[model samples]
Target: MHFFFHGQESLSILDWILRAAVIFIFVIFTVKIMGSRAISQLRLLDFVIALMLGNIIAHPLSDHRIGLKGSVISTIVIVVLYLLGIFLSLKWPGLRRIINSKPFPLIKDGEILYKGLKRARISIDDLLAELRKEKVEDVKKVALAIWESSGEISLFLEPQFEAITPSFYQLQTEPFDLPQTVIREGRIDFSVLRRIGKEEEWLIHTLRSSHHTEINNILLATIDRQHNLQVFLYK
Candidate 1:
């Protein structure tokens, strides 16, 4: 234990472990309070807060000279400021403009806007790569493309180039229903079965008669809204 915690200054193995656990729990609590968008959809404000929090929290974990108390207090203050900034951005239009940039047009009316591309700090080659990612072979097929503040390109295909759906033909279709999993990895999910109003005996009987397999043989099984039991067996 001494060897493991050597050169860590005065922090013993147990002390280091306790500090790590506390920091980990504290960070999780703060993240929950800040909301999922802080990590999932990182805008300018979110990015800055995330960067700052990571830097502040990391130093105390490694350096004994930096106390955990100071880091924790600093983190709480930063999180509060971040929340306040988000609230202010929502209430004040002027402040929002400063924090979040408006979507810049990269392509308009099937023509690439070179000026917009320059403003976005992307070259012609980069624009072509993004187009390729959207499965667009020709620039003329794009009706409009906007560079979002989150650094993602939003592409819209010309009406003529858009994929045809059943709605286009005015065709009738069944209502969409998500299949509920009853069995996974050869184990039956009784809670799911209960929720879907199905019995254990019925599932066993169905597997043996319909799928010609036993419960242990199934890798996955789902029941649809229409009482259709689909089973997949292990390979």
Candidate 2:
């Protein structure tokens, strides 16, 4: 605690450990307050704040003269400013446009837009690489490609090039459902089971009849909307 304010010429092992743990917890709390968007997907405003925070927080950890209090205060102020900026951008369209660049069409109707490419500051090779990532072998197959503000390329295949689905042939298909995990690591999730209108007794009986195993042996198990139970056992 004494070392936090007064500068130390050298830190002992315990001192270093204490400082690290304190900083680690502080950073986690700060990130939580800043919101998920700060780390998940960085945009223009996010990038600037991230850089500023990193530089500010890093000095306190390495330099003995730099106190944690100053860094913490600066971080809180920056986070507040960041939140305010986000709020303002959401309320004002002009400010939003200035902060977040508008998406521009890089390719349209199988033709590449050279002007858009120049505006985006990406080369032909870069465009080709992005196309390859989307599994597009030919540019002609792409109906539209936009350079998004998040530095992501959104590509759309031409109608003729798009893969056919069951709907295309007017064939009926089962409704989509996301399976819920009922048993994980040999433990039954009673809450999930009840939510799916099932009981532990029914699950145990089904496991015995279908998988020929008990709940304890199952590594993972899921039940879908159709009440289909799929079980995975430990290897």
Candidate 3:
């Protein structure tokens, strides 16, 4: 009877360990399949979905009667659905529009759009709090405050009288598209150059002028829209 009890205890322990290992592997696989963006730029609905998914998986992972195979299968199905949503969003613009709507304008032309706030289901107090967080005290100072699809607030400051064009509030200083070095760590990034509207020749010339003989020697380099070159040499 003692030997039988010991055997049962061992079996229970082994079962728990097996279940834990399966749960860990499934969690890692699911997270990898979801991609890093899910954690970084999560929208309101995304957060809720993630929480619910965890809750659903937790029960099967913890309960001994709930088989590992079933849990893993369910996880795979969820991941497939997520991937399908992403693919559909990419393939169909209409689907993308429906799935991920454009930002709602909270403020426009230095005036607070109260109607837009009501449409977004956000109160005036919430809007004011967001503006304050963005360091915008007066609504008149804002060119536009958009409630992004990701549930993040974006602020665009009005142009000062001195600067004829409207300036984005994110950069309180001069608005410039600082040239970013797309190529680094011995890798070539043509996409970044295309983004800045420059060619290889221009980059080479700019580097040469800055006394950079080789791309490998450059630790960092950025070009602003104003054509200003900011370069950092390797230490």
Model 3 scores worst on lDDT over the 10 consecutive residues at 1-10
Clashes of each: 0, 0, 2
Which rank order by lDDT, best down to worst?
2, 1, 3
Clashing residue pairs in candidate 2 (N, C-alpha, C atoms within 3 angstroms): none
Question: Whole-model lDDT, candidate 3?
Answer: 0.64
The regions of model 3 sitting more than 4 angstroms off are 1-41, 44-49, 161-235
**Model 1 worst lDDT run, 10 consecutive residues:** 32-41
| Candidate 2 lDDT, 88-127, residue by residue in tens | 9999999887666788899999999999888777789989
Native-referenced Cα lDDT, model 1: 0.78
In the range 141-223, model 1's lDDT, one tens digit per residue, is 99999987667789999999999999999999999999988899999999988887879999999888888999998899999
The TM-scores, one per candidate, come to 0.79, 0.76, 0.50
- Per-residue lDDT, model 3, residue 219, is 69
Candidate 3 lDDT at 100 equals: 58
What's the TM for model 3? 0.50
